[model samples]
Target: MGRTNLYIHYDAVTNHVMTRAINFEIQDFPKHYFPQNIILAESTLDFGRFDPQTNFKLIRGASEIQVYFESAHKEKMRISNWIDFETLEDMHGLTAQEIAEILYLFHANKALKSAFFYKLQNNYVYLTLPNGLNKVYYRHVQHFYPRFQRAMVVHMSELLNESRSLFFMRKAKVQALPLEIAEQVAPIFVNGLKVNFQQAYVKGSRHFVPLDIVEDELTLLTLDQAPKNHIGFIIYDSNAEKWSLELTLDRD
Candidate 1:
C-alpha cells in the first residue's frame, strides 16, 4: 500500500461502526476472530459505483452463507457528503446528524498523528469470531484491491539525491512532449536507466515528467523483478494538484 488510510466497519450485533487508524495485515485478523481461511471478497464495483442490492457469500468450513444489503431507499451515498436520514436508517441506526458527526470523527481520527483516511466502499463483510478462538469478537473485511488510477500530486519544486551517491531515475513519462517543447520539460528523468535526459519521446503519459528547471538531483530506480534494488513511480494527474505519500511494509 502506498499511503495507508483508516478503514471503517459496521458491527450488526452491536449496531456500531468501528474504524482502524492504520493498515491491518492478514495476521491481525485472528485476534479479531477472522479465520485463516477467511478470504476477503472484493466488491464487483471495486473502484466504481456501488449497487446496494449486491449479493455476497461467505464460506465457513463446509457451509456457505449469503449476505445482502438492504436498499437505502435513496439515490446514492458518497464519502464526506451529507447523508440523508433514509440512507442512515437503512445502513445503521444513526440519524443524519449523528452520521455526519461520525464522518467528522473519521477525519479527526485520521488527523491524529500523520494518519490518513483511506477510501471507503459501500460493501464491507463482517465476520464474527468463533467461541474460544481469540480475544476480539469480530472484524470487517476491507478490500485488498490495488488502486490503478491514482492521482499523483507533488508540491516540492526540487528533487533531492543521496548525500554522496549517484542518483538514478527510471519509469518517466511526459504528456505531450515535442522536439521543440521537449527542451522545456526535458530536465526530468526518463523511463530507462540514464544519468541525464538526452532525448525523450511520448509513448504514454506515465513515462513523462516536467522538470523544466533542474533544481534538485533525484535518482530514479528501475522497477525490475527479483528485488533489483530500484524504486519506480509513474506520474499521473487528476488535476487536483495534491499528492499523498503512503508507506506499506510487510509484517510478521
Candidate 2:
C-alpha cells in the first residue's frame, strides 16, 4: 500500500488494450530504506465497451490477475503468471478513447497523477495530465549548514505543480549556547556545500526524491499534504536539514 504506478495503452485501430500496474511495499529499514518489491499486473481488454467512469469493476477485477516478484528479473519465478495478450483480447471486448478519458478518470480517482499514450498507428501521442516529477527536478535546492538536533518541520505541498518550483534563502537567526559548547561546534558556517536535488519520481499521486543527503539537507521527496488535481509543492523535497526541522507531511 506504499507506492504504485499504473500504465495503460489502448490502440483504436488495432483494438488492443494493455494495462500494467506496479505495486511496492516498504522494505526493512537500514538494509533497504525504500519500497523495493515490484508487483506487476497486466491485462488486455476489448476496449470498445469499457466505460471510463462506471467500469471500476473492470479495473478492479484485473487486480486479481496479478503476479508478485522480489526483483525485476523476468526469469524470476512469479507467484502467479500473467495471461497472454492474445487470450486476453479474445476474452474481453473493450474500446478505449483515443484521448484517453480513462486516464483523466485515473487522475480524478487518484489512481495516478499523469500518464502518456503513444499510439502505434500514427505515432500520435496524448497525455491527460502533466508531470510533477519533471517539475521537481529543476527546482533550486540550496545547500545549508546547521548544528545537531535542529530538524525543522517544514511545509511545501501548497506550492508544487506542473511548472517550475524554486527556493532561495531568507534571513533567519538561532540562539547560541555557552562559549565552551560553541567551540566544540563550528560557530560560523560557510556557504558552497555544492548541493542540488536529484531526479524525482511519481508514486501514485505523490512525488518523491530518490537519493542520499550530505550533512543536513531534506532527504525524503514527499508532499506535506494531498492537493486538489494533484496540485501542491513544486518540489517534494525540503531544503531544511533533518536536525533543523521535523518533516511534517499533511497526509490529507
Candidate 3:
C-alpha cells in the first residue's frame, strides 16, 4: 500500500452516499463501475462536470447498482488546498460542509498539539505532524459528486516512511540494527521483515531471503532433496552437501 486515500461507499438500493477520513487501500474499480463513470461524464453537458471519483455502490444486490451523478450544489465549493487531505461529503442527508469546516479549523488552528495545520504556501495549506511525516492534498478538478466542499489530498514523498513508522510502530517491538545499515535499508527490514540472515551462505552476490517461516515442527532434508519452497529443511555446507530437517505434524 503505497499511499492511502479516503474512500466513499454508496448503497444503490436507496442511493445513499457516505465517506470516512481513513487511509483507504487503492484497488481497481469493478469492471461495471468504469462505464457508469463514463456515462456520468457524457450525460452532464453544461456547467460543472461529474466527478468520476468520490463514490461508488459497494453492494451488488443480485443486480447492477446504478451510479449517481448530480450537482451537489448549484454553486461550486472550494476550500484552501490542503497538505493532508480527502473530501468529505453531504449526500441526501450527510453533512459534508460542516465536517470539512470543523476539520479545516481544527488543523488550521493547531487545536491538537500532536497533529494540526501548520502553514500556507500561496494557494495551499500545510499540516504538520510529529517526526518528518507529511503528505500533500489537492482539490481535484472542478467536478463534484453528490455534495462536497472540496477533495482532500496528500503529497507523495519520501516522507511515507515517516508515516509507516509513526503509524505502525506504536507499542512496537524494538530491535537494535547495525549503525551503518540504519538509514540505508532499515525500513526494508521493517516492511514484512524480509531480511536474509543467511545471506553470507548464498554463493556470489545472491542474497536469498526466506519468504516466511511457518511456526511448525522442523523437518530434516538435504539440499538436493529440498522442495521448491521449504522451511526448516536443515542445511549447512553446500560444498559437502550436508543438510537435514525434522517435521512432526500431529492430526487427531
Candidate 4:
C-alpha cells in the first residue's frame, strides 16, 4: 500500500486487461512514503456490470468510487480482484461525450477544489470512457504508457513527492488516520513483523506526505496505530518455476 506503483493495460483489439503492482512493506521503514488505495482482490474479476450506488455506500477520503461498485459478489461494495473503468460505459451505454459531461457536472463544481484521476504511465491520455483498465484517469498515463512498458518500470523512487500514488521519498511526516478508517488496513511487514487483524490494534500509514515540513524527516514508515492481534495472512507468490501461497494459520 505504501509507495506502490500500479500499472494498468487494456488491449483494445485483443480485449485483454492487466494490472501490475509492486507494493512496499511499511515495516522496512522505507525512506519513501506514498498513498494507499482501498486495496481489494478477488479471482476472475469481471469487467462489466459494476452497480455504483453513490449514496449510503459512499466512503469519503479513504475510499474510492470504484470500491462502491459490484464485483463478483452480490454485495454492493464487493469488487472483484481486478478493476477497469469500462463498467460505466458498458452498463449505461453512454457515449463518451455524455459520460464526460456527467463526470464534469458532478465533479467540476465550487465545493470541490479539484478532482482528477491518476494513472502511472500516461500523464496526458485523453481518456474518453477509456475502455477497460487503461483509464485510471491519472491522465497523460497513456502518453508514456508505451515508454514505461518497454522499459518495465520496476522501481518508482525517482518520482517527485507530490505525484505519489506509489513512489519513494527521503523523509515524510506521518499522520494518524481515524480509528474506523485505520482498522480496515492489514499491514505487511518485510522484517517478519506479525500482524493479526483479530487483535485490538490501531493501523494506518502516513499516506501522502506533504512537502515543506519543518519537523524531523521520517526514516521508517510509522503506523498511526500498531495492532496487537493474531491473524495470519496467506500470500500467493508466483515465479517462472512455480506458484506458492505463503503462511498458514493455526486457527481458533
Best lDDT goes to which candidate?
Answer: 4
Model 2, 102: alpha-carbon shift in Å? Answer: 4.3
Candidates ranked by lDDT: 4, 3, 1, 2
lDDT of 2 at 200: 36
Candidate models: Cα lDDT each? 0.23, 0.23, 0.24, 0.25
**What residue runs in model 2 are displaced by over 4 Å at the alpha carbon?**
1-69, 73-195, 198-242, 246-252
Residues 76-109, model 3: lDDT tens digits: 3211112222221222222455335435433553
For model 2, what is the error of residue 101's alpha carbon versus the real structure, in angstroms, after optimal superposition? 5.6
State the lDDT of candidate 1 residue by residue for 13-122, as single tens digits.
43223332222233232233323122222332322233333222122221111111211113232211111111312434434554344344343322122111122212
- Say which prediction, candidate 2 or candidate 4, comes out ahead on lDDT: 4
lDDT accuracy of residue 241 in candidate 1:
28
Candidate 2 has an lDDT of 0.23
Task: Give candidate 4 misplaced runs (Cα > 4 Å).
Answer: 1-97, 100-102, 105-227, 233-252
Q: What clash count goes with each model?
A: 15, 24, 21, 20
> Whole-model lDDT for model 1 versus the true structure?
0.23
Candidate number of the best TM-score: 1
Candidate 3's error at 59, in angstroms?
Answer: 20
